[model samples]
Target: MNNADSASQSVQTMYAERFATDLTDNRAEQKELTAQIERLRDRLEQLRTDETWLTGMQAALPGETAPPRPRRAPRTGRKPAETDAPAGTAVPGPRPAGRAKARPSRARTSVKKAVPTAAAPLHQLIRALMPLGEPRLVREVHADLAKAHPERGTSVQVVRNTLETLVKRGVVGKGIQKGTAMYTATAPAASEGDEAPAAG
Candidate 1:
């Protein structure tokens, strides 16, 4: 009876040791698998970031053919002269030789000041002041007109609104002076056919 009891105890110790070793091996394997999963997640995040950056770059850039690239003017043995455009060929680049002084830009052409006889009273008043030959502020123009022509009784706001309208109409030139708007009257150019008759 004593021998049997001792053997049973030894068998129980061996089983406990085997169970502990199996548990340890399983834990190690679990730790290794968890680390591998974390690495994959980090790599996925990096790839997503790169993809987002690439998408943004693509959005900001113009389409490839937006402005057809200007072909390089073919090189010739002799450099062409300013006036030496070869005949019968479309100038192969951005600008053709002697571009007719690019028609004055719209902004320049439109800045024509004319106070016709039938113009609004405010416009006529502003035009009359053009003889001052300098840009004037809205406040200054308003004060002067009020003082000189009491009957007009124009308000400062009226002057400002009128000035803004005149600027849009190209009848008045607007400039910035000392960070404030300054207005100047522009005279319409006389047409070529309307030249004054020569005095005898």
Candidate 2:
């Protein structure tokens, strides 16, 4: 009778151990599943934002004649050139090479106190800022620029646009890690004395 009692106790102990092990595995699985759900939700939000932007862009595509009605500025070409000078001062990438040379002369005449080194193309600065082989966020790059070279005072949007342009031109590689956009240099990182060779 004592032997039987011992056997029953041992069986109950084994069952208890099994239950604990199963419970631990269930909790771990729940944690993993919860993480996956959060990631999916984040990704879905990103996709929706992209979709809305893409829709707006498609509406403005050249094939759409509706855009021409609001684009009545073609009648005043000189006015646009005068207006775009400020845009050139603000963001250099979109302005044409011919306009670029013309814009800087006016900018230097106006904002002469702005650092000469800051006149270096933002794209060039980005090429200089990026380290080899590691992805970096636009804001991260902008922060370093703001810190190390405060003279090159620029906004996060400008940095982000410049990086995206570089990505399209094959001068930089873009990545999205956990819903954040990042860029890495495709060319060797530029040195203090040297500028990166532009991609064709």
Candidate 3:
């Protein structure tokens, strides 16, 4: 009976040692897996940071690799007052503070019949063609000029060209309204006081 009891106790001790070894191995495996998961998370965060940096760099570039803007032109050798005048047009000088009044409205048929020599200056003709406190088309100016000076023969192209020149000089404002180019005089007629010295 004593021998049998000793044998049984030995067997129980062996089984306990085996169970402890297995539990230790399981704990080691769990630790290794937790480390691998942490590494994967760090890699994902790094990738996100790199992506954000690349996006910012793209935004900094102008128009996404657009060409550089051209330099501004040098000033002309002409005087500041003559600056308002168009090329090839005769500008006597800068206009006086007080300008001459426009001619009274006349019949368009009579104005059209008038000779070129009798025609009013182009700038004066344009002003007379314009209405108070509103924008007018080049065609409207041409029509009005015909009415005001029947003898004068001003073409529609000529009127448009003159208006563009006026816009560059800053006396007139140009803008697109309803998909059409419209122009208005920046200064009021009362301030203009009748005289438009600049020639067409």
* lDDT by candidate, in order shown: 0.52, 0.61, 0.55
lDDT of 2 by residue, 1-200 (tens): 99999999999999999999999999988985675566556656644443433333333343433232223334434334433453334343233333435545654364444444445677777777788888999879987776665644466677788887777767789989999997998876443224333320
TM-score of each: 0.33, 0.38, 0.36
Off by over 4 Å in 3: 1-119, 189-199
Worst 10 residues of 1 by lDDT: 64-73
lDDT tens digits by residue: candidate 3, 95-179: 2111211211342243344434354467755765576558887767777776665444555676788888777766678888898
lDDT of 1 by residue, 17-37 (tens): 999999999998898567556
Off by over 4 Å in 1: 1-120, 188-200
Error of 1 at 29 (Å): 84
> Candidate 2, overall lDDT?
0.61
Of models 2 and 3, which has the larger lDDT?
A: 2
Error of 1 at 101 (Å): 66
Q: Sort by lDDT, best first: what order?
A: 2, 3, 1
TM-score order, best first, reads 2, 3, 1
For candidate 2, the per-residue lDDT at 176 reads 90
| Residue 163 C-alpha lDDT in model 1 | 73
